[model samples]
Target: MNTKTPAGTEQITVSNITIDIVRKDIKNIHLAVYPPMGRVRIAAPFLVKDDAIRLFAISKLSWIRRQQRQFAGQERLPPREYKERESHYYQGKRYLLHIVEAEGWPKVILKNKTWIELYVRPGTTLEKRHALMTRWYRTQLKKQIPALIEKWEQIMDVQVNGWQVRQMKTRWGSCNPDQKKIRLNLELVKKPASCLEYIIVHEMVHLLERHHNEVFLAYMDRFLPHWRQLKAELNKLPVRHEEWGY
Candidate 1:
């Protein structure tokens, strides 16, 4: 798409090599580096100058490359099929999945020898398997979130109004300080329970500090020392597939 710039019409490149700039209803320029490969995105204001954008990108090239390398080196597990010998993660421990077809409702069982039993209907599609796993995940998280919130509230001395869970596409969690509420992504339940606690603590800290600045880092370090490691693990995990909108 050709964008109208003050200096006539200057073309901007968007490809695998460099960044893609998009304009949206956002307060500030937000940069993101995606996984599986180093894909950079820059969301700038529509009225921002092209030269200024290029200069900002060039100045941050080193930091951007470092972020890309960090994302590139992150470990990612292969997608799982709810079949025998398949692996599933719970509380940071890996277990082989054992598929069992029972007469009634489906359930997950942790058998001995590092195994998980997935009881589902016959001929279940990948989406169905994911749905079943997600449901189980929410169940697991619901058991843990309350305790974590109670713990963090004591430590941070912050009381949240409420919290909820869902399959979020782009965000790990979000907070509305005005409402004193937090929203955590349901996918986190598939990860280690520590990961869910980390997200909860992180978002809860947002009630104290809004942005990911020094204050936020200090809060995380004080509240959860291993937050960076947990964040890395969380990002490396497979994200839900998204349907793009115009």
Candidate 2:
């Protein structure tokens, strides 16, 4: 079996398009088009040369451009200071943030799904307020995962050992077939519910097929025929505001 080790990171330019190449002890090179922006990443076996990786990226230039164009049209969330009256998204819907100060720990409540009431102690630091918001987001995302996992497990006839919600910079979700584990981006909670469901199903499908190869595509098509539409819709929404290393 191939050994597991920390992956190496490198930057390469192919036809004026930059690609981040991650070197891992794997059998084949896997290319991923990430969202918020279509940053391309290639996970390749350690023996592969930078030149070979460049050539591979060059070969997929058209597909890369298409994915980038898609991201270019999507809306982008601006840097948030967690102030009152600011816009926030949950499950694909928009809500105005309403902050109320009290002498206790912070809390978040949805006001009729149209507004988010953030209760924070007076004189709370900006970082603390942001943390409260992030914690709320994590809780919301976590609540949605179980039902989706159970539903997909039945449909896909596969069971994941566990799944987690986390702050992810690159992909929305990933699955490790060996460990039967799945991880989803916590930022996904800000998007539409359909988008979140799409990601959950997408990762679950990975249990059946590891690579985003034709077989994987076929499985996605067979199980979630509307996956392409859902993916497009998800990509069309505003990506979370983060300082991404591209």
Winning candidate number (TM-score): 2
Residue 20 in model 1: lDDT: 68
State the local distance difference test value for candidate 1: 0.74
Candidate 2 C-alpha lDDT tens digits along 182-214: 999988898888888888888888799886666
lDDT of all the models against the reference? 0.74, 0.82
lDDT of 1 at 233: 74
TM-score of each: 0.72, 0.78
Candidate with best lDDT: 2
User: How many residue pairs clash in each candidate at the backbone level?
Assistant: 0, 2
RMSD each, Å:
5.5, 5.0
TM-score of model number 1: 0.72
